[model samples]
Target: MKQKMLAKAVGIALVMAPLASQAAVENIQYFGYAKWGNIYTDNDDHNNGKGERNDVIRASEGYGNYRLGNELNWWEAGLKADVWQDGDAYFDTTLYLGSGESWGDVSIIQMWSAGHGLFASQPNAKVWAGERFYRRHEVHMIDIKYWDTSSTGIGIEDWDLGFGSGHIAWMAPNSSADGRSLHNIDARISDIAISDTADLTFGLNYIFTQNSSYEESDITTSGAMLSALYRQAWDYGSNTFAFQYGTNALAGGLMSAEGGSNRKYSTGVEHDGYSWRVFNSGDLNVNEDFQVMYSIAYQDKNLDNNDGEKWFSVGARPQYSWTDYMATALEVGYETVEAQNGAGTNDMYKVTVAQMFQAGKGVWARPSLRIFATYSEKNDEWNRGGDTYGTAMRNASGKDSVDEVTFGFNVETWW
Candidate 1:
């Protein structure tokens, strides 16, 4: 499907090339990203083999965009697709055509709800998620949205406010959200805005979601959410300050023994041009089962700044370019996942270093050498033990996480 789609797009571009030279023609663009690397982990317990074929090395993504009449007076459309070696695929596209004038830009298009964009922004970057493995796809279905911007009259340094409303596939219900079905139908309006400041910035997002999570019985759930973020860069002092707060309604499994909201707050800073960065996510639960991470890089330019496809979640990485096609990075991180309310606390530590090299162009080939090691203070951190106390996390497929080395290469390409 992806190859055929790309070929069709190219064929159209070729046919339109001559037309573009004479008359108005839609401009089409194509791009893709690919990465592959060897991965290894050691747990000291050889239940799983070391130097195993790292399955994390195969992934590809591509996107296409077309614009009519060149500028802001016409129509636009975009399509994106991603496929992983592990047999996972994602397809998303949008088409909008409208004109901009005194009434603010208006367009009718199938796109992500304002709420969806806000909620997804919580993740730090493109690559990293809370866990090592990708979560099941949970996103809204197709919906029509009305967007309007150009309304604020703040000044030279004015703020930009955008609003959109539409129906979408809600992720709160279904077996994925626990065995509860709230008969939730997607119908919601979301508003979002970004404030501009010479040295500071802030963003606000609000969503009016309906027919939220459900329960086996007649338990009804519906509500709203508000998220705000602020950041300031102290260029003279070479420092930065940031803070974020968000409140979300809870139902079904997320509902605590006592009804309350599921909220999160975080703050952190960095200096010396991002040689260091720190961030932490905290939960509203009294137990405060949160995750904290701090990372420091040895390179001058943060690897993240140079990364074409930012892949880590905890934060950006700094890479050393050995050559145009090769680079290496050393990363070490410590994470704290507080034991459950009744369970004692357990801490886990991990350290990884990898050297990656790339070859080819379209589907550039990549290979890397990596060493990953993880250990828990209480052995039960990742459920090393069986169903004992619900603490162990087992990977019978791979060896332990204490000390292991992986060596492999992944070849991938995109249109």
Candidate 2:
């Protein structure tokens, strides 16, 4: 259905091309990103073909773990174009589609339009309606987006404040917000130059209660969140440190701080709870042949009902470029999680090494092909029966061992 809808959009655009030309409309080029890959366990009897991670038991909750060998197939692509530009006034629009493990599982992820140039004092100011992936941040190696407010609604962006630029948005709950009809407001300020070598960003989000309180039939609740990041740059690399806090229905382990409307529903419960996180990540270019990325993150979540979780993780991936288009990398990552008031703890460790063929020289180069091997192990607590992953996480022994070796190949590129 989504594919068919996009097809109709293209047809309508072609039919209106002549009228668009007369209206000063300009067509922008296409843009997209994609990563296609798979992994298989080496256990002869199991015949497993999935990416494994220590983060799996938590169902990939708060902070994510190492991504290289722990990722499956996924991709998203989109287009942007100018509707019309008449001197100080203009309009623009964007649309995109995303697919999950299977390409057939595709959906329209972004469809929005904006108008600009109306505010002469702030020529960069823009008012937009529809949906957009606005103001998102992620730790690449861990594949965790600590800050995100992407949703389907209306917003104003790029306001020039004296200290920094500012953004504000309203996300509706019709087909978004997991079908909850609550008022959601998100606001943030960024690009604040704290020093010659540092900058900062801070965001606030709120969700108003509509159904009074939580009942069997009513899942709506009031919530609030605050998030901030401090960024610094040096000659070889840059680093970003983040802190996030959320309360009640708007947070869980430092997320939903973005207001949770982008996904089908909140990844966490809608109970009265509090969540917070402290995290840091950086990418360094040691030399022409060696590059490394590292991160450390910790998050805590607790609910009034006495059920919650805590997560701590650290990982690094270092690559060496042998030539202009070839390199090798080893990724080592470790993670641990504790039930707020339940069990002791569980820990996981993983390591992977991949040989790569790429497009350019730097460690951050694009369009790379990687052939890799990985080893991962988990504590006995997770290996016990009746775990979240069940037998899928089991090893050949399947009795009390929770470890596996995997190998795979992937083609990853973005623009």
Candidate 3:
């Protein structure tokens, strides 16, 4: 208990340390997020919860994006700086290194490479996968990333891209049983073009990995992903229209554990005045014997099979702004995933809603409140020819699917 409290204190101190610089710089700006929340998992044991529990508060700074340094000149020079939380662990630093350029703006330190996926995908649908209380997970490792934006010349704005290489380990210690240590490297490019009604963006990434546990020890595996997005604001008097599409693919060794090649496609559309959006994601397992090896124990297992699973999801999200400081949002989604090999199949349904309010610019320094809820179900069936298998997998923690209500306050600023 004392150790946890001490860690919290240290975190608070580190965050405040940057505030001291605010007094000296004329053009410096500071901003961040701080909140206290709890977790009540239906499957308490799923995320190493000893038992039913209540955590007082968990403070998070910037979600995962970190801003480290400031540029004095538009495209002449600047330094690298950032201090943000990765899950529960915080990385604090303001180092001026790796200086360069692509189009116009000066480059600081390389944070993201071109070889890794660019988009920010959500975690698993499970809460346990969504929350990280005390562990520092999802740390970013960049081999080298530099950017430039002067290529567009005066009046026209260009984009900045980066290239990097490094290995991806799930956590700090790399403890997964089926963990693969590879000499993988990826690159990324973003902020392409800023036009009146249209913008273009693209990214490509590749990963090469190896599993030492295999009999051959030299299992060279590789995968790549490409993404392109374009959004235009259409003027229809009181309303507007926008659309987006993205696709990803994984081949080679990554397909070994899951069976075959892995591919996913997603697209979304929204309107200007209307606070509603429609989107869909489709996943396809190209191999018949690809299985994902997961465990409640966090242990690795042999995940080879004679069948595969393919699923698709469709959802709608609508939000309304009651006042400049108050709003309400609702979401409904349905997804179905199935494996064919005479083994079994699983299907799921989900619905969620949230009402949020703010006192001062969405900050709790004065105080704000948000209410949210979600309900989900998973039905499983196993039938091999005329033979019937065991029952489906269910939440063993004794609670139905899972339910919870989160209430919290945030205190921070950005400039």
Candidate 4:
């Protein structure tokens, strides 16, 4: 009797498979963005002290992405694909067909399989593997990924946890010889009531690395990182505050060059120390036609006995819209860096004004064409003696400060 029942169920499923396939929707999409422009400055001869030309204003470097993907579904397999390139080489290189040379190599930034319904308890969960862009958050104006832990990894995302959700991922270096692998776990809780009109969210992330030897020193190393975030939301917009602390080997993740040998003070060595950063971002809308976005970040790191370094940056972008398609924007940014042991301090300032044409009414709307003018100033202590601007100017004219103005028009869009 049980065998008969099982056979009957299998026959019914085969008969319904065609009907179910017809009712299921399959989707594919391609999306990308492009930006280009020219910049001209009043003076183009400034150099850092080195012989290299350190022009204050030059042509803008551009970046682009080409992505194609299918919609994720529980019962069907899908593919996520991407090709990306950045920097001036993409514009300056010459094309060659069969000479074993090309303009530039296009990189596969991400190519992965993604789908949902991996677990019955977490029906909304998304499971994926292969090279991909993991969770990364950034400060828009400065292009700083304050919470960047992106890597080639496998992970499950949006796992329901009653009150919120969780994600777990494991990432490894492309080559086993580079370093040991690492695992990351992140949890986010949302909609904690702050008031009738406000809500709060909290997030925690942790990373741990396996033991590995550093190629330069041949010393075994391992490390960990912990990060926390808090956010508050209201009718107009939201604000986010975040902090991260890590050991020297894991400050910016085991694969990050920023905290290891590539750090400014640590040239080809890693030591026992600590690193931390504090960051905040705010988006506020004053009215239908006006809005503001601002971000501030501070980071400090100490390695062994080396003089620790401190960095601070703050920037703001404000815009006023006259209509859905027209708006004016002004942006100002400043950054300063110093050594804790009084090695030196450097600072720079930049300002930009732009008249923009966009398809939408908000400050965050994309697909924009902008006519812009930018002004920038650098102090004597800010990369002054290096090869580009400071050394070039001092060598040429003995100038202590460098100022520049750039004007250009550029268009950016995505679909």
* lDDT of candidate 1 over 332-375, digit per residue (tens): 33323222222222322333444555442111123332223222
> Number of the top candidate by lDDT?
2
Rank by lDDT, highest first.
2, 4, 3, 1
Candidate 4 RMSD computed on C-alpha atoms after optimal superposition onto the true structure: 14.2
TM-score of each: 0.38, 0.84, 0.43, 0.68
Point out the worst 10-residue segment of candidate 3 by lDDT: 61-70
Give the range of the ten consecutive residues with the poorest summed lDDT in model 2. 53-62
Clashes per model (N, Cα, C within 3 A): 18, 0, 23, 12
Model 4 ranges with Cα > 4 A deviation: 1-25, 46-105, 174-211, 214-220, 252-268, 380-400
lDDT of each structure? 0.24, 0.71, 0.27, 0.52
Q: Model 1, which residues run further than 4 Å from truth?
A: 1-25, 38-220, 223-225, 231-318, 322-326, 357-403, 407-415
**Model 2, TM vs. native:** 0.84
Tell me how far the alpha carbon of residue 39 in candidate 2 is from the true structure, in angstroms, after superposition. 1.0
149-242 per-residue lDDT for model 3 (tens digits):
1010111011222221111222111112233443322233333446655554443434334433435432323334433334343331111111
lDDT of 1 at 307: 15
- The local lDDT score (0 to 100) that residue 380 gets in candidate 1 is 26
**Decoy 1 TM-score against native:** 0.38
| Number of the candidate with higher lDDT, 3 or 4 | 4
Query: Which residues of candidate 3, in runs, are more than 4 Å off?
Result: 11-28, 33-180, 189-195, 210-214, 217-220, 235-308, 340-342, 359-368, 382-415
Q: Sort every candidate by TM-score, greatest first.
A: 2, 4, 3, 1
